[model samples]
Target chain A: MRIGDLAARTGVSVRSLRYYEEQGLLDSSRSPGGHRHYDEEGVDRVAYLQRLYAAGLSSQTILSLLPCLESPSAATSDSAFDRLVEERDKLVTHIAGLTRTLESLDELITLNRKRRAASVADPDSGEPGRTTQG
Target chain B: MRIGDLAARTGVSVRSLRYYEEQGLLDSSRSPGGHRHYDEEGVDRVAYLQRLYAAGLSSQTILSLLPCLESPSAATSDSAFDRLVEERDKLVTHIAGLTRTLESLDELITLNRKRRAASVADPDSGEPGRTTQG
Candidate 1:
């Protein structure tokens, strides 16, 4: 398949796939016309890279951890082990912060939604203050 | 409290606090000596801003959502409601991806730790291959 196809399947941008290729995180071959081509494995690899990037992992960190990710049961490099654990801890803290943010946003959203619902149900009072809140 | 004190209390930079003030997300008063001052409310406001930033909310998006955040029972603007829901959905998807990444990193870390532990227990074979696997 083509690079664009892989990007479509993974829901990642073509530019990002190219960036991953540049970072040595993704593999692609050249077609007869010199366009990039990928296989099914490339799709899974791009998805994995996307997750790591989503966790705010630097390309360098992902590179360090790739060995262990690829061969999980094999003897792993010390650097990879250390990076993995460090990233995991950082991610835990980040997730906690984001969860709190989500909760706060949820509260605000719920409050607004409830207000809209209540006002919409009271047509007499709502008619005067109508303003596309729903 | 002084701006520096607020920074210290909130674990945020004076520059960031000033930016938040500029964005109207935070409030501060200038003293006779031309120093910015804040109260306990500043601390909480900074914390809230930090959480929103952590969840990848832009200053503009936060500005749009601030009305309901400040006065939960007040009628929310339509723009605020829309932006809040949009940002909430984005954060939800982002958190899911990061959680998956964290789990993957955990698996890799555990695999490497097990390999190291196993190699160390078999020191007769490990001594010859010892190279900081732990």
Candidate 2:
């Protein structure tokens, strides 16, 4: 498949695909006409790259882990396992932070709902806000 | 306060602070000698910007939503609320995606652990892998 088709299939931009190739996370052989050609497994490889990128791994880190992930049957080094554990820990932290943000957003949404409800309930009182005049 | 001080206090890089200023998410004044200067309130504003960025809102979206977040007591337009709701939905999606990734990572870790345990249990059998020879 051509690079364009791979990009279209993966929903990743051509520029990003090129960057992934440059970063050594992806590979594409050049055809006789010098056009980039991807193998049949390119789609799965791109998807895997997307997952690792989405998990907040840097290109460098992904480059290191890509081989290990691709060949799960192969004996993985302790360092690779450590890096995976580190990445898992980072994901845990990101999830926790996002959960806190979600909680705050929920509180804000609830507050807004109550304020809107108050506005509807007391149309005469232009100021039915929670903040009391000090 | 100088940009360095703000960077140190906020834990955001000086380069990023400048980028945020360029993106209109932050503001700073230049001194007589042309050094960047931040007010006392700049710290809080930068922290707020950090939270929004961490929530995965782009700088453009942050610029639009910053005013409403800064003034929660003031009247927020319906569109602002809609944008906030949209951002909240995005955050939810991101959290869900990360959660799924975390589950996969956990599974990989478990599989690796099991492989290691099996290898220990069967020292004579060089091939303790899950993959069966076809």
Summed over model 2, clashes come to 0
lDDT of 1 by residue, A1-134 (tens): 99779878999999999998888788788988899998788877887787777788889888887766766533666777677788789999999989887887786677667777777776434323322111
Give the DockQ (C-alpha) for candidate 2: 0.25
Fnat computed for model 2: 0.19
Note each model's CA RMSD in angstroms.
Answer: 5.8, 5.0
Quality class of the docking in candidate 1, CAPRI style: acceptable
Listed per model, the TM-scores of chain A against the true chain A are 0.74, 0.85
Q: Individual DockQ of the candidates?
A: 0.33, 0.25
Where does candidate 2 chain B have its weakest 10-residue lDDT segment? B125-134
Per-candidate local distance difference test:
0.75, 0.74
Candidate 2 global CA lDDT score: 0.74
TM-score of 2: 0.75
The per-candidate count of clashes, in order, stands at 0, 0
The candidate that wins on lDDT is 1
Residues A1-134, model 2: lDDT tens digits: 99999999999999999999999988889999989999878887887678778878899998776544654432666677678778889999988988887777766666665665666666544433441101
